[model samples]
Target: MSIPFDRAPTATTDTQLSFDSLGAPLHEVTFVIVDLETTGTSAGKSEITEIGAVKTRGGEVLGEFQSLVKPEESVISPFVARLTGITHAMVDDAPSIRSVLPSFLEFSLGSVLVAHNAPFDIGFLRSACERLDYHWPQPTVLDTVTLSRRVVGRDEVRNHKLSTLAAHFGTEVSPDHRALSDARATGELLHRLLERFGGYGITTLEDLAAVRQAGWAKRQAKSHLAKGVPAEPGVYMFLDGTRRVLYIGKSGNMARRVRGYFNASENRGRMAEMITAAQEVSCLPCAHALEAEVREIRLIGELAPPYNRRSKNPERNSWIVLSDEEYPRLSVVRSTTALEKSSAIPLGPFRSRKSAQAVKELLDTLYPVKRCTARVTAATLAAHRPCVSSQVGQCGGPCAGVTDRQTYLSGIADLFDAMGGDFSSLRRLCTQRMTRLASEARYETAAEVRDAMRSAMSTAARAESAQALRAVPEILAHSPGPDGGLDLAVIRHGKLAAASHVRGSRAVADSSAAIRATAEWVPAPGPFPADTDSLPEETRVLSQWLQTATLITEQGAWSLPRSGANFHAQESGTVRLGDAV
Candidate 1:
């Protein structure tokens, strides 16, 4: 007589099944071992070539189901056919996905779904379900791969592949890599794993279903985020499984940053750690820089992200200015408060103590201002000798304590003048010195003054370069043509350092606005020049063309090539050499 594959009848007698009676403590539990042969690796366009599943409960084999499905796409690859032994002719008469998916679903029901690398199988199943508009509520998914990893440890298991696992478990796997044979081997492997590692933690069907659904959702979300992220300004938030925010960050380009998280091979060490810990990702888009900044601050405050607390703290967003008194001393102060208190005075807001120190060092190098310790009075100064700064004439001999209050106050005033963004006074001083030297017929001294002036001007030029580069505007023009196009370049020291191809008129306008907004900013060192001659011939030629033909600027530069049509002088855009690229 043929064995029945249908569901067994439930007991009508009123006897409850206890955990012990159900064989809860036993090494073996029910599992529906599953495997699929597919046309390709990608689930998006690929179709299943074959399907196989075997149901077992309490270490007893119950039933088996297998079928070959005709894939909708034409031409199975030669390699795929060779590996699966399922040729194009064999599946030509087989049912389509619509006809076969229901049967597979029915067979997989009421048993834990077991597979090696469950993600691969589930991904394809989910994709197929989506395409067919079928609702295959996730079954309890038990990945022997994950179980083996846990039981054998990652380092000890050189190969945890299905065939490897079958071999390791001493099960002979015939027709390897094919769906039905692989499914049978997986069933045997599951039996050995349960025996070796104790019964799976799965209990209720609902419990298994919940775990499977959650895992599926996570995988789907990750895949969607990876493929669907937009390349635009936005803020991203990372959350744990409990939905508690872990980190928040803003990027001018969102897709690139999102992709960075999924780049396993390149960022394997870091990504491996992050992916295992990360539960979900959330993102928000911002239309502009100010909008993005505001949104970021508000979300950071609302979420109280653990990693962004430093930026959110009011105390950390402060500036410190050294007090100018008989004893000059460092004063801790808030940026907004200080800016409000002394609207006319110059102050520098620092993000950290290290930043503050760096600013102080820059001030000392540029201005050589006095920074004597507060404790040193005239009497104390007389007892000790002068410090190195005083000896070098960089300091006004504050250690000697001989200078009057007025003179010290005057020096402070000079420092304040320099810090107030007023270089005119320094220019006047150099001019006066040059005039005096010229009157004495000292051409050499005059030349030295000229060199000093160039040096000073270079600083201003560098500041302009920095400002231009920092706030690059959106491209205003986007078409590829001669008349309405803008050539952009990032110039350093009169040489083209970097170049970009921008065509949209709107992009040009946006980029111009961005550059203007950051015109006063200073450029940082190590900017890649677009017009460097060291590059390939074509790149070098392009760089030179952009540098000489296009308007160059310290901040950034742009120019629209002259269109052939009659262009009024006022209507025509003029090119300036000092614009940022």
Candidate 2:
């Protein structure tokens, strides 16, 4: 989820550009430091027992509101009673939440709400408002915990808990879980955070809001590294002083994105560390976002940058392949090198082992293929006994000579057909299993079966898409660019050969000619383009984009397969994979 900071207002008039953009000054803004003692941690299940708030402006205390609220629908748990020192006897004569909430709302009107852990307190208040049918005045909220992390380094405190922060800042009041004392401590901590932020140019609420979501001083200190970066759609590489690439990323606006890393918007801790180590920014301007994305994937796959988490190990992608034995069984393999030497039909280039295993499990459950690992040949059938899977009817009894070689081969052919594109067999079996599971009220297991079926279909669809693209020798496609022009790409085989952006209708023809002339030469790929330098991920990326693109020209066959993954059903929530096109 993105940060919930109040954004700077857009200037509506020429005179509103300068001082108005800064927002309300910190000292001038009315802030309500609030705290609540609750029955339990869960806002949905708990009730607030006490409320305390301090209204202040310009370092002067305006007023303090404190109340012991009687619970309407809940009793104070023994643990909470001891923690907050608020027993049932103490709040028995106190007012209920329904009466006290309205007054609290009136007291905190038109002010920024401040709390140590704002979510916990705000969640309880919102839940109360919802339960009591009161219109919640949605006030701007600030969490001192979030703000403290941005300005206060770890050297000063072990953690950003309320007690830790209050002690670190040497506040006059120490938090002891009582609502009023905690509120006072939180108010003091908020002032200290503001004081620390003054050197980082956080004088206004707008500045505070922008930096609240990220580390302030570290990013501000490294802001100059992004100054030389260009403003264009492209891939960027952040390098250390010795010129080693530390991180790789792609964005439409390179300058703004790079600058964001040095600002309060980029909150990722790893990214903050990368920015600190980065001394130089290198850019590779692309024709458009598509080219930038494709280039980024290839670079990450090749360079294996330490900072990039994904697309770095394309070679480690696993695939589910059927064994070439007489009684074929499903197995997951990483190297497609072995499949080249055997007649085993490969079903996937699945990104994760778990996905490939899920598909394998689904196929194993659907078909009566052999589940045992023992190589059951005609010569060894006399010595083999039926395995547990065969006894349970999950596998054909090929080892006990119950299933003949021709029959087993026929079943293997059907399995191969299902893996190729036809999902009828798997779909029929999965539907039955799901129905049975649903009847038994095992909805989670049914959902898992549903997901596995979807994954199987998706794997088949991906393979077919790649095969169709590789079959086509050449394809030139164009889409309406973001800048009101044409974005054209030259695809050879299944790989992106070249990309170009034409700014006007008149330049389309000339740009196309130049792009085609300068395009990389890609030979006719075989059944699979696994040997190609580009990752299969790149082809998958192009496949998604080409679904919406207009084909200006093409050579050889270029069409979506008749059968594809249909996870969505037009008629009902339950997927009828058998009816999928």
| Clash totals, every prediction | 40, 0
> Tens-digit lDDT track for model 1 on 1-581?
10111221111111121222212333344678889999989899789989998888877778988999999985689999888788999999999988999888877776678888888998888898998999977776878876566455456557888766766667866438888888888888876766644333333333223232113222323534444555555577777788887777676566656654542212334334445556777776543222234345545644567655534542353344555456453444654444444423433334455545544544453444565564557576767666677777766666676555567657656446534434455456656767988999998967766554443333333333333333333212112323234434333322222223334445555554444443222233232222111112122222334444434233334332232111111122211243212
lDDT of 1 at 40: 89
TM-score on alpha carbons, each prediction: 0.34, 0.68
Candidate 2 C-alpha RMSD relative to the actual structure = 9.0
- Kindly state the number of residue pairs that clash in model 1: 40
Per-residue lDDT for 348-458 in model 2, tens only? 778789998988888888788788888776676786678898889887789888889788777667677776666777777789999999999999999999998777776
Judge candidate 2 at residue 115 and give its lDDT. Answer: 94
Q: What lDDT score goes with residue 316 in model 2?
A: 80
Q: Residue 166 of candidate 1: its Cα lDDT? A: 67
Compare the candidates by lDDT and give the number of the best one: 2
Regions more than 4 Å wrong, model 1: 1-234, 249-274, 285-294, 297-322, 326-344, 365-368, 375-394, 411-414, 422-581
Scanning candidate 2 in windows of ten residues, the lowest lDDT window is 8-17
